[model samples]
Target: MGKKDVSISDSIYDRIKERVEGTGFDSVDEYVEYVLREVVEEEEEEEEPYTEEDEEKVKERLRALGYMD
Candidate 1:
């Protein structure tokens, strides 16, 4: 896929440039793309949604410990 251009604040750009010097990144854009890809992938792995059965189990546990009526 082709890359897209995105704008960021000068301060953030400077920060990325500073880190790029010692890092294996060839440029700030490369580092940003890598970081963004990792973040996007991590976010994609979402947890399953809560269901009524799960809520009922919690209530049962609370009742066993005398925390619920």
Candidate 2:
């Protein structure tokens, strides 16, 4: 895959540099890529469409809480 350049504040870069010291990451770019990939994976996982059973459960909860008739 082709790589592109991204800019971040010096302070953030310094923080990441310090955090990666004594760890497996060789550079700030690798650490940032790993973290961003993890976050994106989590977001994708949460994007699953709600099912009819899921909607019914939410409605039932609302009824129990007196938010619905």
Candidate 1: residue pairs that collide? none
Instruction: Assess every candidate by TM-score.
Output: 0.64, 0.65
- List, residue by residue over 1-69, the lDDT tens digit for candidate 1: 897899999999997898677556789999899879856965785475548997698688556534589
Give lDDT tens digits, candidate 2, residues 1-69: 999899999999998898777666788899899879867976887868768998798788656534589
Candidate 2 shows a clash count of 0
lDDT of 2: 0.81
- Scored by lDDT, the top model is 2
Candidate 2 local Cα displacement, residue 35, angstroms: 0.4
Superposed Cα deviation of residue 34, candidate 2 (Å): 0.3
The model with the greatest TM-score is 2
| Candidate 2 off by > 4 Å | 47-69
